[model samples]
Target: MDHDESPVLDALAEYHDRGYLDFAPPGHKQGLGADDAVRRVLGPEVFHSDVLATGALDDRRSSNRVLERAQELMADAVGAQQAFFSTCGSSLSVKSAMMAVAAPGETMLVGRDAHKSVIAGLTLTGIQPVWVRPRWDRELHLAHPPSPEAYDEAFAEHPEAVGALVTSPSPYGTCSDLKSIARVCHDHGKPLIVDEAWGAHLPFHDDLPTWAMDADADVCVVSVHKMGAGFEQGSVFHLQGDLIDPVRLKQSADLLSTTSPNVLLYAAMDGWRRQMVRDGRELLGSALRLAHAVRASIDELPGLRVIEKQLVAKEASHDLDRLQIMIDTLDAGISGYQAADWLREERAVNVGLSDHRRILAQLTFADTPERTDRLVSALGDLTRTSLPAPSSVVLPEPRDLELEQVMLPREAFFAAQETVPVEEAADRIAAEQVTPYPPGIPVILPGERISAGVIDYLRSGKTATMVIPDAADPSLKSIRVVADT
Candidate 1:
């Protein structure tokens, strides 16, 4: 495998060199029909590369195997047996992986800390989720990936479960011990699906947390756009071992994928694969160094502390990706939401994930000293500013946050539903998902009996910086619940 040759990029070049014309569905016809204003804003090259994947990118028959070759290169680069590209982002890729391993009505052991997308997959596919509890950091009010023992216990209890899925390098960058988790799954004769959406760069760097493939995960989904240089929505899922059939995985993806795939997204991911193979170590190494320096500097700032030791402690996450510099703003007498708002409004800087007490700044190979210096300065300014008092979020105890699932998610989601006032919604089965954005983990999932503690948390948090984009009523005044029988 010549890593130097990028099939998609080369094919795209050939497509231009051959001067192929399109009268296809895009209707833009290579920007000729595109409005001048749209062209000026998006650039003509965006439209130029927006060619049809089957007909224009690889000919009508796809005899060139352009996409196929690119996928091969990606799998080889990541040390996986097979790889599939997705223009729909890791959300879709993860759903495909889940469906491939477990069918409707089958059980899959899933970490409760999974992103809202995974919950959506459960609802859409009707896959029964045996929720594995994550190792909760009680002091930090955060959840790390579930421990390997948790999965083992889950499988022991539900030996009928088809497979397991866990999110490593969580949005906050705390990682699970994937090698041990994968072993637990295999010991039960079940495959492991790692939603390693934040770990695309792990393979290129040794100091980082272990890559899912290296840990012998049967299937792993990664978003190249997150940790690698690629267009948004660019994602790749890799498969290894005979536990999951490659044909079934592809078919599962096809069931949910778009008929009109984006060639630009394909080209970007193809090129990123080549770039990472050639120069990823050097680039990611530099990024690691920059992140360390930034972390130390931020920790030195008054009233601010970068979380590290606590995250990888014995009872917490097995590993931590330091590039995710999580700053605890509690000592600064300001909430994470307040600091995030100040940085964006006053300093024109945007931090990644923000919660009641912490703000995360995600660093990648793309960051430089100058860029980091700006972040440090903005953060320094944030500490000195006298901001408005943050609204109090009525956070619940870890035990109270775990709502009991009363019905299947699909059943409750599609059942006759009623909108009820938040004050009276407790004890009722939820008919919708109410999640905090950024981390995007659902506090209230469909089919789960809502609790007063969780309701208070969401209502109070909403008054602060919490943005619940998926809630039917973002205002939190009312909630959608399964109708009384």
Candidate 2:
């Protein structure tokens, strides 16, 4: 398989070159019938590239095997036994990996600091989750990836567990000791899955933290859109070793995937794989240098601290992806939310993730010196500007933050439920996930016993500009809890 040959992209080019008119499901009919305003904003090319994966991109029978060939090229480029593309993003891909490793009623080891998507996977699969505690920074009020010993403890407590799943380069860019964790899992004859959505560029650069494949993970899910040049929602899950059945992984994905796949996303992913194989090292090398310079510059700015050293200690994370420039904004006399809003509204610059006291500006190979300079100037102006900090969130202790699980997430979530005031919601089993978006980690997952402290934290954070998009009641005035039988 030639890594240079982007089959999906080539086929898409041919589809346009041959001028094949489609009477297919996309009622827009190649942007001709699309709304004038939509066409003007989205451009006609997006719709033109929006063709059926099998019928248009390949043939009616998919005789060309364009997608398969593209996937093969991706696998070869990444040094994986197999690679599967997902148009639905790594949210679906990670869930598919989880389901393939552990079935309903079985147990899987999962880090407590997992993204909301991983919690959703637990809810969707009915797999019992043996929670491994993440390394909590008490002073910083942040959680890093759990250590290999945490997984070892979890497996010891639940020897029946089928496998383990960990999130590397957490939205904050802190990485777990994947190699040691993979060794721990493999020693138990179980597979290891890495939810590495923030690490699509990791494999391309050796200086970056070890990606899942090189660390010997059985399966790893990546979102190309996050760190690569692919369009949003483009994701790929790579497989290696014989621990996980490739057929089972495909079946799991098919169960949750769409029947009508997006060819545009497929083509972008195919093109990106070729790009990475050819020039990823040089491109990422440039990004790493830019990130270091930016971090140093940001550190020099009064009242803004770039967090790098504290993020990679033996007690914290095993490694760090420097591209994710996490800044402590509390020193700037304004909350991260205020800083983020100001940057967007005033300077037209948008930071990636923000919290009560921190803001992140994600750097990628696509970012240039001009872009980073704009970010620096905006942030420098932000430090000089007079903006009052928002009210603080009363963060709970690490132990209090760990809610006890009484029922399986699926059962408690789908059971009889009722909406109750925040005060009365305490001690009740939660029927929904309440996450702080951007970093998107669920503070309270379904089936967990909701605590008054956590509730107060959510309500206070919301009042202080925290956004919880998945909650039934984002305001925290009320919460949905499993009804008593």
Candidate 3:
């Protein structure tokens, strides 16, 4: 219960003090065996901190209670009844959360705009998805988290659903009305799991989008690496109330989580929690002000519309994360993709989460006036000497993109399947997911009856240089489908 005690850091410090040398799993034993080239690039400190969580940080039996105590402090920091750290990031944490409440073949209400990882969860577990459609802002051609009414309709149809999951503060900075959605879920005795991966900094700042824990989400997964000061892949999921059993959640995480957990990640998580508790509010306050200024400045540029309060318009999202600077490049005669490529290649400014319509700049407490000024200057320069715009990327409309569920995802994924060229695989039931990265929503989730329109869009997307890492081709040229047996 002591907020000041960081068990993970304490144990790590103890291990170092005791001169705990290991001949264990990590071939790079305390940087002694690390290649000089590797140490030069990654630094010896990284290898030194990569000690075994149990064998090195604590003892074999873990009598020190290092992880357990660290989790408790994290829970306290976020006002959650329980918290579990995951080195594998929120992607794994969210899957574990889904399986904890719902089992194979059980129905779970899910937002259709979820990350590709959620679709992966569906394919892995046999959970039947009851899709809750996101509030699509057709004008912006962007997807926001589903409104409460959308989830209400979904629950009305599948009242027997075990739980609901919503991705609030969607990658584009749009947020759902989680408080109302939570009330809706609680009224039906269903737990609400918020994929709040980009919301780790929310709790500390009042002006930011409401944190899931504060909004009454029963289970909230957050990536400490996002909007927080931590190493990449640092993630934690917090839970409160009787809707979800914390013990079951921990057990579920343990089943999917890695056995050789990273002590460096745990220490970073500990350090981040302490930093946030001590100075997050002040740091975030400055970042918010800088974001507002930057957004206003970006708006003055030709053909650049900074999607800010424009997102909060009742016609769009219910709420918005102000720090998310979404710049629409369509008016500039360039696709968001083109603008992103040009900016990065020309000015060395990389925007986060680019889509056909917009490039999103994810501002964090780490952002400063200097960095934002650089971004604004780059954009200003980009539009001035622009090359010919990219050919129009034919994006599928909200309806055209939606696929018909022909079979269960698990069956289609695991059942007899054949590989065919993507061009010829249209109209066949998709046996694998073909999703565009960046927003990472699958265009072709397994078991869905693929449409020609969707295929054309994805194929065209690939031609335009869309990153589809999960696909067999990454170019969406080949497709996997249930074979005619």
| lDDT of the candidates, in the order given | 0.93, 0.92, 0.87
Q: Which 10-residue span in candidate 1 carries the lowest summed lDDT?
A: 20-29
Which regions of candidate 2 fall more than 4 Å away from where they truly are? Answer: none
Candidate 2 to truth, TM: 0.99
Which tens-of-lDDT digit does each residue in 1-485 have in candidate 1?
A: 99999999998899899998777768988999999999999999999888899988888999999999999999999899999999999999999999999989999999999988899899889999999998777788888889999999999999999999999989999999999999999988999999999999999989999999999999999999998898999999999999999999999999999999899999999999999999999999999999999999999899999999999988899999988999999999899999888999999999898999999999999999999999999998988899877888898888879999988899999999999999999999999999999889999999999998998899899888699999999888999999998
TM-score of 3: 0.97
> In candidate 2, what are the lDDT values of residues 1-485, reduced to their tens digit?
67768899899889889999888768889998999999999999999988888788888898898888899988888889899999999999999999999989999999988888999898888999989988779878899888998899889989999999999989999999999999999999999999999998888889999989999999999999999988999999999999999999999999999999898899889999899999999999999999999999999999999999999976999999999999998777788899999999999999999999999999999999999999999999998898865888889877778999998999988899999998898899999989989888999988999998898888889988999999998787899999987
lDDT of 3 by residue, 189-238 (tens): 89999999989989998999889999999999999998788788899999
**Against the true structure, what is each candidate's TM-score?**
0.99, 0.99, 0.97
Model 2, residue 210: C-alpha shift (Å): 0.4
Give the per-residue Cα lDDT of candidate 3 at 318.
73
Prediction 3 global C-alpha lDDT = 0.87
Residue 254: error of model 2 in Å? 0.7
